[model samples]
Target chain A: MTTPEPDRLFTPPPLMTSPALTPPGLTPPPPTPPNGVPLPYQAAPPPTTGPSRAPVVALSALAAVFALVAGLFTALYLGERTDRDTIASTRADQERTLANVTGRQEQADATLETNRSRESTLTTQHDLLTQCVEAAKGYFALPPGQTPESSRLFRVMYDVCPQI
Target chain B: MTDHVLSIPSPPAPPRPRSRVAVVLLSLLVVLLLGASVLTIVLFVGAKEEHGLEVQRLDRTSRSLTDAEGRLAETEQTNDTVTDRIATLEAANAELHKCADPAKESIIAARSDDEEALRPAVRRAAENC
Candidate 1:
């Protein structure tokens, strides 16, 4: 097998003139004159009908509708967002108020507990004071010789009421 | 021999009027599509952010309310306890006064010099008052 010339190997085949050999949907090239010049008088392919306006118009209309709907939705969303933000802000304010109220409540509870403790202490002190008064009375009523300094009533008065 | 010359093809027919209209319509469609797309994206993003913030705020509010309720309940219980304690204290105070009054009078009436009477009175005051 002789190696073909490189130019011949790369050269494209002549256009197919046989209609049967042409690929489907492809028209065979028109025959050239013996002079090898193609005729320029060949009919121009019927002016390619520009795509019908109806489809593009309909598509444009649909797109316009989509754009309009989108615009409306955008407005609605904006309003919704504003309303939601307001609601969120209100809720935040409520949270702050609740926090303040809770803080106040805790303070009140602490104050109440302190007052209760103080009141209890005061009540206890009052009871002790009353006992001390009664003991002093008893001590003073005792006759001079019989009134021993070591007596329980004297001790009670001295412990609770040093002023006496 | 005559010279062979190739004739130049005429310029392609000007674009059809209908095709120009179609081009304009397609362009409009593109613009509308772009606008719709941008709007949709903005709406989606805004809604997402708002939803997240709203949810967080709602959660915080809910928690705050729960805390307030708990505090209120605690305060009420404390108030009731304090009120009951105060009532008890008052009653006890009244009882203390009841016991001390007559005893005080008796001690006051007794004479320091009267050893026999004073001794009994002092003993009764000490034991009961």
Candidate 2:
């Protein structure tokens, strides 16, 4: 058997170069007109951008949060103001009602006092009338068959005697 | 010949982001605040006006009450005076009734006529006639 000699100083084969391939399931679409004119243009994918959509979305979310916070604060402030006004109005109404009630109570008390005074005066007048009736009875108690003139004198005495 | 280096293509620029929604929301908030401020101001002004009217009404009522008080006092005074006058008239009437007894005159005449007067024994029986 003869031993084959090694290929010393042998040059390696050239590297194999491949053409760029689109991703699987992706295809280059036919160019379409943007303004009714046919043009050969490629649409840029959305992901490869200066700012990621996440940052813009975050900024938008922050702005929305700020707006919501401001709106909530404004709403609360307005609600508190409305409550203050309502409380103030209710307090004023209550005060007015109390004043009216107090005034009516005073009027009623005054009326009661006046009526009591009138009643006392009437009671005194009734006593005086009773005394007059008693005196008339005394005159009627005169002896029977007394002359009409004598009876008339006795009646005059009765009318005047009540004063003493 | 110049040697050319291999190059890599960079990604395309993304579309510029818009702030339309934020702008619209800010404008709406501004309008809402303006409307609320106007409403609050109008309500405050109306409340003040109502308070003023209430004060005016209370003042009018107080004045009327004062006038009524004065009238009531005057009436009470007048009533007292009338009561006093009535009492005096009643006393005078009672006195008149007492003194003007109709039978008083007849009683006095009866008493006087019952007492006969003798004139000096008729001048000693008229000097033996």
Candidate 3:
């Protein structure tokens, strides 16, 4: 007995039609048998619907990875910003300390300058006082018979002390 | 009739529930990615600007500290010198007073004597006192 042919009623219809049946500007359909029977072992055309789930899932995973990277970058930036704030605070403190130190140094410098001037005046007075004392000692040591007005010691005393 | 019935394909299988869920999840991930990227860029720029300002402030503070330290050192040195000079002047002044007072007494005692002796004592006292 001959093998029974596939029943046309039960055979599923081809999803695509022939190129002649397709409209212009539209993709032509793959070649199909005139009787609308699919050849055995022929591969089905790819679906025209949207992308499959695998590529979508992969793209979603990639997006998740990018988001994770961005989150990590944000965390790092925040930490660095905090560190910068800390540094800025420290710098401000250092500046205040430096200002105080500079003020103190300036005051000390002024004190030193005043002391130096006083010391110079004191030294000059000390030198003149010493010379006057020496002249007095020499004049008193001279003999009583010597005339005081013509003496070198008396002249020195007069010059150093005009009050005499 | 059978061909007509077969030709009319059954309505496309209803979209899978899981696929819809995946699309929603993908959209949420994209939004998350964009938000995170924008936040990262903003934070990065803010951090960079702060770093620049901090560096400038730190450099200025360091220089000021250095200058202040040097000035303080020089001031201290000058103060020491002045202190030493003051001590010397004080000692010399004490010695001068010591000698002047004694000589003044000697001149006073001589003033009661004869004119020849008294004249030299008067002149000496004038110079010393």
Candidate 1 Cα errors over 4 Å, as ranges = A1-93, A96-100, A103-107, A110-114, A126-150, A161-164, B1-15, B98-128
Give each prediction's root-mean-square deviation over alpha carbons.
12.5, 17.1, 9.7
lDDT of 1 at B125: 54
Docking class of 1: incorrect
lDDT tens digits, residue span A23-142, model 1: 999766665533554455656566555455676677777777777777777777777787788778778788888878887788878878886886787578567757766776666566
Tens digits of per-residue lDDT for model 2, A44-125: 5455545445644655565566556556655655665665566566566656655665576566556656655665565454
Q: Which candidate model has the greater DockQ, 1 or 2?
A: 1
TM-score of chain B of each: 0.64, 0.61, 0.65
Per-model TM values vs. the true structure: 0.54, 0.36, 0.65
- In candidate 2, which residue pairs clash? none
Clashing pairs in 3: none
TM-score order of candidates, best first? 3, 1, 2
Better of 1 and 3 by lDDT: 3
CAPRI classification of candidate 2: incorrect
User: Model 1, B98: alpha-carbon shift in Å?
Assistant: 4.2
DockQ of 3: 0.37
Candidate 1 backbone collisions, by pair: none
Error of 2 at A83 (Å): 4.1
Candidate 3: stretches off by over 4 Å? A1-51, A145-150, A159-164, B1-21, B101-129
